[model samples]
Target: MTPAARLSAAIEVLADLEVRRRPVNDALRDWGQTHRFAGSKDRAALASIVYDALRRRASSIFLLGADSPRAVVLGMLRLGRGLEADDIARLFSGERFAPDALTDDERARLEAPIPDMPAASAGDFPEWLTESLERTFGDDLIAEMQALADRAPVDIRANTLKTTREALVSALAHLSPEPTSHAEAGLRFHAGDDGRGPALQVEPEFIQGLYEIQDEGSQLAALLSLAAPGEQVVDLCAGAGGKTLALAAQMDNRGQIFATDIDARRLAAIHERLSRSGVRNVQVRVPRGRFDPVRNPQVADPLADIAGTVDLVLVDAPCTGVGTWRRNPDAKWRLRPGALVERLADQATVLDRAAALVKPGGRIAYVTCSLLPEENDDAVSGFLERHADFESVAPSNVVEAAGLPHLAEFATPGGGLLLSPRRTDTDGFYVAILRNRAA
Candidate 1:
């Protein structure tokens, strides 16, 4: 398909997403299913345009002076795809299968220089999140949010249980992988201008379980768990075992990791991943039916036998994922205050559960892929208030122990560490290490 046609399709998909309020992937998939003529490249290109448009949705709307899908596409061409006026006009020339010719007003907006925008619009984030963003970054809010608006580089963690970082880097040499600045086991890859990164998944090394696609921030969060060998650890919300596998490697597959999630469907994928990564120390646990998996009493509790004996409990709690904007930019637009509230509740629940499993003097590493203070600092503060037995530990100490001493500067004022796109050149992740008081 022509580039213009691809843009047209993207506009349609964006409109569908706006109207249906469905996920971007679901909208794109439905579009592809209906338009069978669009090949793989065309679908991918359309998806990219739609995603880029969403990433800069507020800025695009503000510049174009309209909220229509066509206006968004036009603005995205200027901002995200970096197309000149002539370039955008060419794509919208009303030629065969192209978008309708741009109106004089549209052309003028396309050619005009961008005006100084308000903090929320300038940062391409929700207006309601301005306070939260400010709370998180203070005077640096614009820079920090703008960093999130930018495209994310692909990062993968070498499965040290299967292969060393050096070995995986050699195996995927053509991709020009570089060691991540903070994550010792991580390698970074730059996605091309077209948003296409190397097909590392199809590589023989990946098939043989040499590496797993994980963000550097995520790898560092898992490392902050400080799961050493022969220590009992529980990945309380181990979705797909990304961190669980990392913990297994840290333990050198010696200690047991009770990997469980509330949703069994999410837990299903972890089994296959555990097998592929050669992680043996992790035991999968799930509660029966649609119930609270962590605290369910009727079902067999895999963690029951190890409760109060666990040295570490990693709570990769569910959140609004404000930190993952670079990858899931569309989600930011969909996020609501209600959703944030729900995630806060979930974080509290998971942290409380973790507190139960942790032995005296044992630690709970509360982690979230959220930049919102409500989910990070506020949640931790609330947890500490509720659980008198637990006290906050300096996250800098955890970073130092994890051998990323250089990252000590990223710790929050409350002793938790916040890794952000602007500050750490990684995803927005918050990690707080809290230790239980000894009996």
Candidate 2:
């Protein structure tokens, strides 16, 4: 496909995104299914263009004095992608599905946007989210948000118990573009020719459970939890067992791992991952909502069995995934303050209930992907204050021990780590280990 046609595809998908409530990824998938002839490169190019347009959606439209996908794409080509007007004219030329010829005003704006980008616009987020972004990121919001606007690399963590970094690297040779390990077991593969299949699904090693396709930042999340071999641990709120697998591998399949979640579907998904992972220690625990009384035996009530019994608990609590905008950009536009507040209510409830399962002196690694303090720092402080027995620990010590540098600088005053996308070249994650005091 010509560059122009690819741009045309982006315009179509973006228009669909604007009109329909469906996510960008969903729209792109539906679009691709309709056009099966599009090759991997063509699909990737079109997808990239559409996402780039979304990232700069506000600024691009504002600059071009238009909000349509065509106008946005035109502004993007000139501004974000550094295309000349002639280049856009060539791409959007009448020969292809590209937009009609750029209007004189668009051409002029293409030459120069109002300014580099106003404070709110540079973040490439909705104006309403600006206060939250600014509050969460402070002076660094622009830098981090800009990074998010770019493509997130394909991150994979080699299950050290099953495969070494070198071994997996050899296995991924056919995937082309050899992967470079960010941390000992973390691999980042450059996006390249893959026939448009889910990258890891095709690899035999992945099928055999040699590695798990998880973000490097996610790998760090599990690592920070410090699940040692032979230690009894409970992965409270383990959705789909992404970190549970990592914790299992860390335990060398030796300790008791109580993996629990409120959602049965998420727990059900972990079976395939666990079986493939060869992790024998994991015991799947399904929960009845906190309101469910113990008299009813029909619902799963595993959290009741282990209250104050485990040495460690990993609370991978749910939150607004503001930290993962690189992968799920459309969600930012969908979220409202009311919805976020409601989610926090759910989080606080989960935390209070989960805290009961952590034994005296046991550590609970509180976690969230959100950059907002409401979901992170505030949550930790509230939990610690409400439960006098619990004391917070600085995550920098754990992170630095994991070989991550410069994070010690962001350690919270009371305790915890606020990882902004700017300081950490990874997702926005807040992890704090709190230990319960003895009576």
Candidate 3:
């Protein structure tokens, strides 16, 4: 398809998303089903346009003086794809299968120099988050949030249980894999101009479980748990067992990792992943009846046999996922105020659950892929206040012991670590380690 046609398709998909309030993938799928003539390249291009437009949605709307789908696409052409006015004019020339000719206002807005926008508008984040972003990032809020609006780098961690990072790097040398700045087992892949990364899943090494796709920040979160050989660790809310597998490798197959989640369907994939990665130390514990509210509540406790014996309990708690904007930009726009409140409640519940499983002198690594202070430091602080037996452990010590001392710069005053695209060149992640004192 011509670039103009792809832009039109993206506008359609964006409109569908706005009206239906459905996920980007669902909207794109519906578009593909209706437009059977669109080839793989055309679909890919359209999807890229839609995602890029969402990434700069706020700034695009501000610059174009309208919030219409066409305005976003037009503004994104200049702002995100770096196309000139002449280039955009060629596409929106009212030709067949192309968008309508630019109106006088659009043309004027296009030609006008970009005006200084509010920080939230410039960063493409919600206006409500301005204060929180300010509190979290201080003077670097714009820089940090703007970085999140860009594409995320593809990151993969070598499965130390199956193969070494050196060996995996040699096997995937064709992808120009570079060692991650901080994650010892992680390799980074920058996206191409087309906004697509290497398809490592099809590689023989990947199929053989030599590596798993994980963000550098996530890898560091698992490391902060400090799970070691012969220790008993419980990965509370271990969706798909990504970190559970990481903990297994860290323990050198000597410790026990009880990976449990409220929803068993999420654990279904972990069994295959564990088998693929040859991880023997992890036990995928599933609650009976899976995710049904009534059934889930009544299900037998999967970890009943191991409570209070855990050396470490890692609560990779769910949250608003603001840190993953680079990968799922549309989600940023879809997020509502109610969702943040809900996630805060879930984080507190998961942290409390982790506290119950940790033995005296054991630790809990509370983690979230959220940059919001309310979900990160505030959540940890509230939990500490509620449980007098648990006290904060300086995350700087964890970073230093993990041999990533440079990350100490992100240590919070309340004794947690915050990682962001600007600060750590990684997805937004917050990790706080808490130790349980003996009674």
Candidate 4:
């Protein structure tokens, strides 16, 4: 397919997303199934255009003075791809399968100088998040949000149980991998100009479980827990067990990790991952029934016996996932106000469960892949108010315990650490460690 045709396809996908309010992947998949003639390259190109448009959706709308799929795609050509007017005009020539010829108004708008935009529009994020983001980033809100609007690099953590970081990096040399700035076991790969990263999953090293595709921020969050060898740990929300596998490597397969999630379906992939990575210390605990602490506390739960005895509990709670916008640009637009409120409630419940599981002097690492203060600082504050036995651990101390003193710079005012695209060159993640003070 020609570039113009690919752009036309992207516009259709975006329109589908706007009307159906479905995930970008779902919309793209349905489009591909219907247009079976589109080659792999064509589908990938269409996906890139659609994602880029979403990433710059607000800015594109501002530039073109319209929110239609065609206008947004055209504006992305100028704002995202940095195409000249002539270059865009060539693509929108009204030829067969190409977008209709650009109207005089569109041409004029494209050629006009950019106007001053509000932070929400300039940052390409929803207007509702402006105040929350401002509170979190203050002076650096636009820069931080702009960084999120950009593409993310692919990151993988070397499975220390099977290979060293240096060995893994050498094996993947063809991909031009680099050691991550903060995570000692992480390697980073830049995406191509087409916005696609190396197919690491197909690499022999990846197949052999030499590395796991994890964000640098996620690797650091797992490290912050400091799950030492021979310590009993509970991965309270160990969905897919990414962090659970990391914790297994940290413990050298010596201590037991009770890895479980409320939804058994989410934990299905973990067994295969654990086997591939040679992780033996993790015990997979699938919930047998609904997990409502108030109604059915620890009912049919595997970790019931270990209550008030765990050395560490990692609560990787669900949230708006704002930090992952660089990779999931569509989610930033799909997010709604009600979703944030639901996440806050879920976070509180998980934190309370973690408090019950932790032994005296044991740590509870509260983690969220969210930039919202409501899910980060506010949630932690609320947790502490409810659980008097738990005290907030200083970010400096948490990083020091993890042997990552450099991360002290990203410490939040509320004693947690915040990692962002602009600050840490990583996805947005908030981690706070609270210790049980009761004897």
Identify the leading candidate in terms of lDDT. Answer: 4
Worst 10-residue stretch by lDDT in candidate 4? 290-299
lDDT of 1: 0.88
Greater TM-score among 2 and 4 belongs to: 4
Q: Model 2's lDDT to the true fold?
A: 0.77
Best-to-worst order by lDDT is 4, 3, 1, 2
Please provide, for model 1 over 323-379, each residue's C-alpha lDDT reduced to its tens digit, 9 standing for 90 to 100.
999899889989999998888888888888788899999999999999888899899
TM-score of candidate 2 against the unseen true structure: 0.91
Cα misplacement distance, residue 346 of candidate 3 (Å): 1.0
- Residue-level lDDT of model 2, residues 1-439, one tens digit each, is 7787788888888888878967888999999999999987888888878877777777777778777878888877766878787777777676756557767777777776357677667777777777767766778788888877665667788887788888877778766534543356877765643213346776788889888888777777787877888988988788889999999987888989999876666787898999998899999877654332333447666778778778888889889888888777778777788878886877777777667888877888888888777888788888877888888766667766667655677676547776655666677777888888766
TM-score of 1: 0.96
TM-score for each prediction?
A: 0.96, 0.91, 0.97, 0.98
lDDT of 3 by residue, 204-269 (tens): 998998899999999999887788999999988898888998899989999788999878788888
Candidate 1 Cα RMSD after full superposition onto the native fold (Å): 1.6
What is the full ranking by TM-score, best candidate first? 4, 3, 1, 2
Error of 4 at 186 (Å): 0.6
Q: Evaluate model 3: give its lDDT.
A: 0.88
Model 2, runs deviating above 4 Å:
36-40, 173-182, 193-198, 288-300, 400-406
- The lDDT of each candidate is 0.88, 0.77, 0.88, 0.92
Per-residue lDDT tens digits for candidate 4, residues 1-439, read 9999999999999999999998999999999999999998888888999999999999999999899999889888998899888899999999999999989999998888878889998999999999999999998899899999999999999999999999987888889999999999999999887788999999998888888999999999999988999999999999899999999998999989999987788898999999999999989888887665765676676778899999999999989999999999999999999999988888988898888899999989999999999999999989999999889998988899899998999988787999999989999999999999998
Error of 1 at 113 (Å): 1.7
